[model samples]
Target: MSQTAPIRVGRIGYLNVLPIYHPIEAGEVAGPLSVVSGPPAELNRLARAGELDVTACSSIEYAMAAKDYLLLPRLAIGSRGHVKSVLLLSRHPVARLDGKAVRVSFQTHTSVALLRLFLERRVGIAPRYESGDVTRALQGGERPDAFLAIGDEALRLADHPDYPHRWDLGSVWLDWTGLPFIFGVWIARRQAAVAAPQAVAEAARALVAAKDWSAGRPEVVARLAAGQGGFSEQAMRAYFEGLVFDFGPREQEGLAVFFAMLAEAGHIETAPRLEFLDI
Candidate 1:
């Protein structure tokens, strides 16, 4: 809404995020907008810096947003079960993950945090951190018993015969708590909402619209996926079909559970209430 410049929107550059970002791709000509894409953490930083009007970032980031952010409606990156993107790959058995040094693929704070909370509470393990490649993480380096990898990297290793040690974080959360896990959501700065509710709504609507477009054209959607984002025609179609994109009552329930889990684990000082934007 800043009349001085065109609105700059940031979107996550991951396959799991394609549906939310498809609108930006579709609107290159008519939407008349400037959009940038990057990892969720980077996008969150830009949003905090006022460099982006809106972005799809880790749901936790939005929860812990720096005093001036708003959650948008009817859009999110979440899964009720078997979220192929978020996985825990282990060299040791799942029950014996205690006192283990595990590497978490960077750019996966929300998943890592959630996983850690689960591990500490359920598995009773305090994992040490080793940051690096997903393949290397499985090698169990100096002290790695397991590694947490999310997004495309996790999907690639889902069914490797050599390491039959894959755990879908979403499914795990659901089994344990009977609630869906919300990985990501869209957010806008408070100023942007006040100054340009319409713009915020437009961006949110664009994301929601992209879901429909992406749903109908699996082949085209797969073609748009490129360059090691763990996206193939088969994978894209499965994800689109299996995963739900709309932020409805179910997603809200998921968000509430996420906050509750975070709170129970002492990861958050306070669990903030969420308000969905009508855009």
Candidate 2:
């Protein structure tokens, strides 16, 4: 596929990203693109450094880089309510831990931002925040009073009896804004689109097509994703159920609300204008 040589794409390593990544990674969808897998944070940095031409990045990353990149149209990882994958795990209820420190995962930045917004704006609890050591957290090492965990680990933590108090970040956002919460958006650097417009366009089409592919046969995607993400097939199917893979008017409204909240919280000077690659 020399026609589109040197097209680099970043795939998020988490299970939630699999519905979109599976086609590209498995060679089912043909593109003259190379795929690299990493957590959302890592992929965000790589895309910023220009190592990746296109990727599904944390929603916050897209906002921060909006001027430098154009979002790929009609693709996102969002949830309406009760997203089991993004959770606040605490030994005690969140309201009761006012003076305690809240540890957070370093994987996805969107959930971190959402958690902060929820705690401060809706819940009215201001706690000290620190990055949780994911490896240590999983192994029962030094523990904090509360921590934000996203992706697969959060899903597992939801059912664990030890963490009695848990809050779904997506549900919290929905309660606060009366809108679905978007965690990640597909994006491509402006230079990549300028240099290889057709490649970039084709890649977007393939990604949107991937969503349709998954919707038509979720069980196939589920079994394949279960193998890739090392989760039970049932669990994978359940996870897919909560994720919104398409971008429509409702999802757009959610993004606007999130951007507004970020601006309101002094995260950005001005909310970014949403731009998409021409399809």
Q: All candidates' lDDT scores?
A: 0.74, 0.83
In candidate 2, stretches whose alpha carbon ends up further than 4 angstroms from where it belongs are: 1-3, 138-140
True-structure RMSD for candidate 1: 2.6
What TM-scores do the predictions have? 0.89, 0.95
Residue 134, candidate 1: Cα error in Å is 3.1
RMSD to truth, every model? 2.6, 1.8
